[model samples]
Target: MNSTLLLKKLYKRNLQPVLTDLKFAIALLLIIALFSITGTVIEQGETLDFYEANYPLHPALFGFLSYKVILAIGLNHVYSTWWFLSILVLFGTSLIACTFSRQLPMLKVARRWSHYTRAKSFEKLPLSTALEGRSLDQLAPVLAQKGYRLFQTDDKLYARKGLVGRIGPIIVHASMILILLGAIGGALTGFVAQEMIPSGQTFAITNITEAGIWARPWLPKDWLVRVNRFWIDYTPGGTIDQFYSDLSVLDKDGNEVDRKTIHVNEPLRYKGVTLYQANWDVAAIRFQVNQSPIIQLPMTKLQDVNNKAKAWGTWLPTKPDLSAGVTLITPDLQGTFLIYGTDGQLMDTIRVGGSSEINGVTVKLKDVIGSTGLQIKADPGVPIVYAGFGLLMLGVVMSYVSYSQIWALQVGDRLYVGGKTNRAQVGFEAELLEIIDRMAGSTPSLSAV
Candidate 1:
């Protein structure tokens, strides 16, 4: 009864809750995975009408899954979600717990050799060996011949081989921790900003995630940037082949600090800020005013109709009258001609989209202003994120490429060898038997299971 109780205690203490921890970890990882996958599928940072019109089959559903929902629930943007961050924290905690609770003691045992008596229970283990009608003589020399360091205790034998097998979980956990550390480092210090600037125009990256922080104490004082020029290339089939921009950075004094040419794939890096060519548009049109320029009398109060007509500008196709006069109002891309014969009198109106003839003066629509769009980023933790990705890949590689073991013991005259592996033990066992047969200078048909 005492032995039974002792065995029960040993089992309870030695056994690890590895499977339960793994299940929890896997579920957390899957949630993060789902968010990542969904981020790719959904068109992020777009207007609600876009989703509603596009997903007309489920308009109400799309409306519910609008930007507000995404922003509130952290779905439109996944990486910065509080719940996602918490999951990562929990994953790291669980990994640390599993590592310490189970792997540390196993490593201690594997690093030290213990004596095992020739009892009936010893042969019951899957990779167990028993001596048949043989005396334990010269056991040390026999074990030494099979590359096992052996120690003896009265009637017991202790042997160990490939002790490094115990460190497999440690290495795996260490790499996972490294990856998690890298991710945390990145999340705490990453930011991205975007702006549109016309040629020969300057702009500052003021806002991120629609949140502007003008009073950031640690931000650079002179975060001014400029675009000297922007260019676009097209393919023969009218497709956008490539795009680039010439950008300049300035300090507080507005001195020519630095300059770089950034392109679609190529980005300019300075002071942790990277400038990329995001997109381009038309802005700031330069066109001629198609009317005679002159000044009109200023009448603050319209006491009389004649005085009110004199207050109008003399630039357009209008004659001075008590009621109306022509006023030429021209915008960049769209122009209009107004013919007012008196004050507050609608004589005639003409827009560029349509045609109008007033006093034989015709106007034509010209050009519009063009703009170059750029996306700038200053992520102090991008390198760390990349490092994390590399470490994660390394963990997978190590987990997949498992290093196994073979243990050979000499019982009397017969050489008994056993094999074990944390994973793929059957394949390794067959290979071990084949190696043993070859060492004995005989061909044994070892079938791989």
Candidate 2:
């Protein structure tokens, strides 16, 4: 008796109720969805300066949201936060627990057999009937036509259709578990970083924006990325039509391993790492002074309110006193520069490989070098997450199939029939009527016994 009471207590508290409670599952789903929405509406993983500039305290966003509040709550990196991860883990636990306790047990009940021995049992069913002179042989043929698996013992028989429906809940729970596992794996092992590499230069991954604590940073160790060239195409109105970056992957010994020219939305994947062309900027200018050695002049942003466009410029002196000089200005990396005279007038326009006289000094525009911004990422759980979603779709479709079941007993020429179903009650009722009509036809006599 003590063991029986203890077992009942365990079943109620630990084994059965916690796992099979629909309200508990619903609560977990709601919590997960709420947090997911929060994660989406807020930006993630930005610099301190960016947050400060965007989310100021004086006139805070929505009257209360500021950078200080965001940083304190770790909203900048929601996906990698401990609380968000804990929610995922708890939701996964609920799915796994529900799978074993509720779904599997329901499936077992669907598969198990129970022969109705008494006609009163048939009366207890949602739909039941008793008739004279109909046997199991008359009912089996009709049930078989409807695709039910049969089980029989002496005068009793059980039949069911759509056993696949019983597996649907299990599949749904299992797929959810897989999805949660994949998300956790990605959060633990993936990394995101960005780099800005100038044209004709090679780079390795060093600027990490956000990475999992357990992420392996030394990935693709033997490979390096080279930005061979960066250029942009312009429309007739001088608007940017497109930009491109020609990239190549090299090995440790400096052999070309892979190559591709990537644009916005196009990317290159090498050895589990993906590089996307995300941005572009002017790096420096190559200039020469009257056939002398090449002088690389680093360009600085022109903060002059005189020109209301994004432009870079550098000033080169022609006189020893630095009083008379020319300012070379470029709006883009299109190999074109606008030379401004000391009196702020356009002196001459120079193209790459072209020369012009500025303050009696022959000045040439060698090259306008540009930099390419690449966003790099490595994720290992994407495939598993995709598979989990596939299974989720399949399971939802299968769950709609309606698992209908029936039982019959022919005891000494008196027929008994009963039926039950989880879904599609109208369909199950129609099937029952057809079977009843067939049995009444085969026996040639019928009565409610």
Candidate 3:
């Protein structure tokens, strides 16, 4: 018995700090929010050179945040860091402690009733009224219609509504815990890889940019992805409208398993892996020289795509004299190129399936081959995350309900009624007046007819 008492005391002591001091939970929330912002601000899983070039040391970011600091603190990948996850775990622990130590017991207390055997007990309620020689039968149906549950005995009665409101906070806490578990599960098992494949090329997932420590077992090892075709649709004003890539999943024996035509926001999924069409590039241009064999020339972008206009250009030797060549430039994958002559003169604008004479030869533009940039991801916790979000929304709506209760007692020739509510003060008062009116307004006694 002494040992049991000691263990109980220790448990109570440990529980008091976590339950009484809410500051720790609040602080954890603020830190998580601040670091989530940092995750968005600082790019994740970038190369050392990328960080060095973008966040250089010569003029470090924000005066003190340098590449060295970011690397050392793991700011480059904050979401998966040990410290951030530890904070989430601590916050969840506090929630569990708070739920069991306070909320559950409070709910149990809320569900119980202390019958007012003495008249003084009825007098203490926030709303109470008395009528001599009356029965409150009419009050039962009215309260029941307002969602108040009814409990009764011979000379005493109790009714309450919106008990569900008491369960909302518990559900909210549980939902948050589920969300944290989902995030942790995803971090432990998710992997993200990138592949830029030209049309007609097949590749396996190898360029992993972001992944959890335990994600290797889940990575694709038996499957191959092929970009069967890629094309871009342009607006009338010569801007991109949309780009599409037709992808096919293949087995080890090269048999096709699945296929999809995907663009932005639309992704293809197979065997827990998802492929998103994130970017597109001009890979090569196909040209035909007037009944001669077709030649495909590789294209390269002229400048950084972000800083300058999107354009890819290639050179073609049109004259056997070896002194003259044509530079073909296209602003987009519109299959239209600005043909520049060897003398640096604007020769002509050529479109796919159109022919132009230059250097005593007819140059026909055939097609422009585009490449698709695919972001491949495998996350096993997506369903759990979705379920958590659903529960969170449900808990929020349920929390709005009011847990109102009414109690009544009878003595000699007097009926005394009283009520209380956990929320909506004005509404509860209105309910009191309404109940009093119903009891007084009834033609017969307030008991069952």
Per-model TM-score on C-alpha atoms: 0.64, 0.88, 0.85
- TM-score (C-alpha, index-matched) for candidate 2: 0.88
Clashing pairs in 2: none
Q: Please, what are the lDDT tens digits per residue for candidate 1 over residues 336-394?
A: 43545435465676554454555444433243233567766655556665775666665
Writing each residue's lDDT as its tens digit, candidate 2 over 137-203 gives 8889889988988998879999988889999878888898889888888888888898988899998
lDDT of each: 0.56, 0.83, 0.84
- Please tell me which predicted candidate would have the highest lDDT against the true structure: 3
- Tens digit of lDDT per residue, candidate 3, span 306-404? 546677989988865667779999877777799997788999999988989988889998888888999888888788888999999998888898988
Q: Report the poorest 10 consecutive residues by lDDT, candidate 1.
A: 294-303
**What ranking of all candidate models by TM-score puts the best one first?**
2, 3, 1
Name the TM-score of candidate 1: 0.64
The positional error of residue 143 in candidate 3, measured at the CA in angstroms, is: 4.2
Better TM-score candidate (2, 3): 2
